[model samples]
Target: MMRYSWLLSTVAAALLGSPATADEFGDPEAGAKVYSQCKGCHQVGAGATHRIGPHLNGLFGRPAAGLEDFKYSKSFQRAGASGLEWHAETLDAFLENPRSYASGTRMSYRGLKDETDRKNVIAYLRTFSDDPANIPEADPTATPTDHDIDPVILAIQGDPEYGEYLSSECTTCHQASGGDDGIPSIVYWPEDEFVVAMHAYKNKQRKHPVMQMIAGRLNEEEIAALAAYFKNLDN
Candidate 1:
C-alpha cells in the first residue's frame, strides 16, 4: 500500500509546479511562545515519546500526513497516500485557517488571525524543533541585513523540484479519488477551504485526535504546498 501511494503521488506532482508564495514568513521566537498552547498535547523534541500526538522533531521538509506511528484521520491518511510535502507557505495558510484547507479534517481550532503573530509563532517554533531554520546566518562580506525574508515564499516559491521530492510521501493516501478505509476523499473539496482547515489544525484550538496528530507534523511551508497541490487537483 505504501509503495502504491508513492506511485500515485509522483503522477500528481508531475501535474503541478512548485509554489510561488513560500518566502513570506515571520519570527520563530514568537512561534515558541505560541506553542505553549500546544504543549498540552504535543512533544517537539527528537526521540521524544508520543503524547496525545506524535513527536514533531523534524517537521519542516517532511511529507504531508507522513507519520508512520500515528493513526491519522481518513482525510489526512488519504492526503499522505496522495503525495504531499509540508512547505512553509503551506504552513502559513494552514495556520491561518484549517477547516477550509481540508474538509472533513477533525481539528477544531479557529485559526491565527494576526499574520505577525503567526509569523512570530512560526519563527519561535523553528528554535524548538527541526521544523526549519528561520534565521539565516549573516554573510560577513555583505551588508549586515536582517531583512525579513518571507519564509512562505522562500520555502514555496522557488523550485518545484524540492517540493516535488518532498511531496512523494503524500501519495500514500491522497492520490486515489476515493480514500482507503481510514482515509477520507479530498479530490472534491474546495481549494480555499482546504487552506483554512490546515490553519484550524495548527492553532491547537481545533480538537481532533487525528487532526492534532497530523497538524502537529507540519510547520508553515509544508502546509502551503499541500494546500496548493490539492487546490489544483481535478475531482
Candidate 2:
C-alpha cells in the first residue's frame, strides 16, 4: 500500500480530537519563505513568464493545464480533463507527489514530504490571485486516489488485417518497416506491448502530445486491431 506521509499530522491531530478551529491555514509570510524552494521551476508575481513550469499567477480555481502560454505535458492535460481543477486539496495532493498524483508527469521535483510545507507553499501561491476566495472551494483533507486497471477490459483480441487499415495514421511518424529514427518503428512488436504502449498514450501516461490526441480517439477494439497488425508485420 502507498503511504501518505503528508496526511500523518492531520490524521494524528484528528485522533487527538483537535478542535475544528485548528484548521491548517498557513501564513502567507511563512509561505513566502517556503515558496523559495519552488523558485527553480516556477515563478509568480508581475510579468511572470513560464519557466520549467507555468507561472503561478491566478492559479487558484484555474483548470489544470489551462495556461495558454506554458507548454504542458499531455499527461497533465489529461488530469485536467478528468475533472482536476486547481484548489487547495488538489494542489496539496499534487505537491505531495506530482508523479503519484498525475502518473508519468515530467515534473521531476521529488515532492514536499512535509505536509505543512505543502500547505504553506499553497498559501503563498494563493497570494498571486486577485481574489483567492473567488476560486472554487475544496475539502482541505482530500487526496488523490490510485486506480487499478483490469486487463480484461482490453477484451478485443488483436486482428492484423484491421490493424493494417489503421496503419495510415501511425505510419506517418513511425516506420512501417522495423527500422528507426527520431520516431521508432511500430512494426514487429509484441501485441501486448503494442496495446500497453497505445493505452499509455491514450491515458496520457506517456507525454507525446500528438500520440495522446491520437490515442484518445482510439477505442480498445481499434487499438487491438492496430496492435495486431504491427505485431504480425515482418521485421
Candidate 3:
C-alpha cells in the first residue's frame, strides 16, 4: 500500500509539472525574503554545513535529528526515536510553533504566526532537498473548513485572575513551567492565537476529543481568560 501510494503521488506530481509551481505550496521567491530570519542559524544550498543548527540540505524526508554529527536536544531525539520525519505538513506544524511541536527544541525563534510565511519558507527550503518536484504541495491535516470566530468574542477582555483559577484542569496535562513531555506547552502563547485555537476546538474545526470537550464547556469570556492567563504565564 505504501509503495502504491508513493507511485500515485509521483504520477500526480508529474502531471502537475513540478510541485514548486503550485501556489498552494507557496512562492519560493517570496520565501527567499522570509528565509532571511533563518539564515543566521541554518545554511543550505551548495557547500552548506552545520552551524548553530544543522544545514537544512536534504531536510525533507529526513528523520528528526537525522544528522549524526549534530547534537540534538533530548526532546528532538525522543521525537526522532518515536518515528518523526520531516515533510511539508509536519514542517508546517513545527514552524507554526517550534517549542509546542518539540518542547525542548533548541531553536529559539518564537515561530511564524502567519500561515503564508510558514508555507513560503517550507517551499524555499524544499529547493535544497532532493527531488523537490515530487514533494507534496499541501498539508492534508490542515483544518478542512474555516471557522469564522465572532468579532465580539475575539475582542473580549479576559480576566487573567479568573483564568488562573480555572487553569487547574489545563495544567494537569500542559505544564505551567512550559515543559512539554508529550502535551504541548501552552505558556507564553499570544492571547489572540490562544483564543483562536480554543475556539477552533470548540467549533470542532480542530480535532482533539479532550480539547473539544474542554473548549465546549467554556464560554467566550472564559476562553479569553484562559488565553490571557496562558499568554502571560511565563512572565
Name the candidate, 1 or 2, with the larger lDDT value: 2
For model 2, how does the per-residue alpha-carbon lDDT over 1-235 read when each residue is reduced to its tens digit?
0123325644665689974343356566778898898889888999998999888988876878989877887667776665457766667767765655565478898778777777777777877876634222322322332222247745668677777888888888877776566555567766655676677668764446787899999988899999788777775
Worst 10 residues of 3 by lDDT: 138-147
Estimate the TM-score of every prediction: 0.47, 0.51, 0.56
Candidate 3 lDDT tens digits, 36-89: 999999999999999999999988778889999999988688677756677666
- Worst lDDT run of 10 residues, candidate 1, spans 138-147
lDDT of each: 0.52, 0.68, 0.75
lDDT of 1: 0.52
Strongest candidate by lDDT: 3
User: TM-score-based ranking, best first?
Assistant: 3, 2, 1
State residue 95's C-alpha deviation in candidate 1, in Å. 1.3
Candidate with best TM-score:
3
